[model samples]
Target: MGFDQYHEPPEELSQKVRTFARMITSLIEEAEAIGWYEQRISVEKDPQARAIMKNAQGEEFKHFGMDLEFLLRQKQDWRAELKEILFTTGDIVKAGERGEKKVD
Candidate 1:
């Protein structure tokens, strides 16, 4: 089966675009791993197993952040929106609205 990241022909895509697609795929995998660990930790009966899952999840989440940072660096508008939406105290919806306005 073909990779989901490439909607178009791979031969037609530039190397930079392919690398970006790979990174996006990686980011999705990291996020999925974090969610999976959360579910496992929630249902796990053993404290030690849950602790290990939590630690692993923390690492996965860190990878997710790094992936997001990489994407932000590549996209100026996204970087601007995230700057407004993240680390601000208030209604989250309001922050998102403000962030959207920032790009427009």
Candidate 2:
């Protein structure tokens, strides 16, 4: 996603902008989890794989930062919920990779 993709806000759109902020944060959270696992698995002291994952993770961080800035500017109250969801998703991804069974 590029800065050019951001459209100018209309004068009367409040609720929808809030919803878009939430959606973008959720998408970024999912992406961060995926990148974390890819980084964790691509090992073997292989410089190439390590380099690739490093760049990918950095991009994910950039994405997260963008969403965070939007949230701060548009929906500060939603930040806590979004952060918790991101951390929970990361934990789930890590557990699944480890073959850990989820307890009902």
Candidate 3:
């Protein structure tokens, strides 16, 4: 089966690289699912159905976080950069600038 995630020849890519690509794809899918759930929850008339959608959205958020953490573990520079930006309260643009400098 052809995997669309790889821009290069899959046979030439390392196993680690292939795993990274799969995880990245998974992350994107999870994020998209979260957005879809958000829209559904917003318009849902049934309270129980909305609650279920919210719960599912929460799971997607967890999946996205896990995938991001895994990817970060593979790249120290990325982890370092995000450390300067994540979970901090301040100007987002400035935080991003700091993160860029850290990676630089």
Candidate 4:
């Protein structure tokens, strides 16, 4: 069969797609946590912490970009969910640090 005939994936292939989506979601969560940790380190007055944070941020960014590229290639609708999770995590971290615990 050609491309069109193979377009409708079977149930097993669908499961694989879901698994890939979940994997990307996990990577996004990890990247978000690393980003937040890097931010916290950057606020430190010590030069060593600042340097560590800079390196951490770079690594996290690379991971984030890779995950995004994979998600885009998969053409899944979970992209918004991943974005929301990262944004929510960042907001929560910021709010808790301020003792406000507010989210938007």
Local distance difference test, each candidate? 0.93, 0.59, 0.95, 0.62
Best-first order by TM-score: 3, 1, 4, 2
lDDT of 1 by residue, 10-40 (tens): 9999998998899999999998999899899
Poorly placed runs, candidate 1 (over 4 Å) = none
What TM-scores do the predictions have?
Answer: 0.94, 0.43, 0.97, 0.49
Best by lDDT: 3
Question: Between which residue pairs do clashes occur in model 1?
Answer: none
The worst-scoring run of ten residues by lDDT in candidate 3 lies at: 95-104
Clashing pairs in 4: none
Residue 88 shift from truth in candidate 1, angstroms = 1.1
Q: Scored by Cα lDDT, where does model 1 land?
A: 0.93
Cα lDDT, model 2, residue 82: 48
| 36: Cα error in model 2, Å | 1.8
Question: Deviation in angstroms for 65 in model 1?
Answer: 0.6
Residue 89 of model 1 has an lDDT of 99
Query: Per-residue lDDT for 1-104 in model 2, tens only?
Result: 43422366544557677477566757667576667757575653877777777777777767767766665566554554344445454575564434332221
lDDT of 3 by residue, 1-104 (tens): 88899999999999999999999999999999999999999999999999999999999999999999999999999999899899999998899999999889
Please identify model 3 stretches exceeding 4 Å from their true place.
none
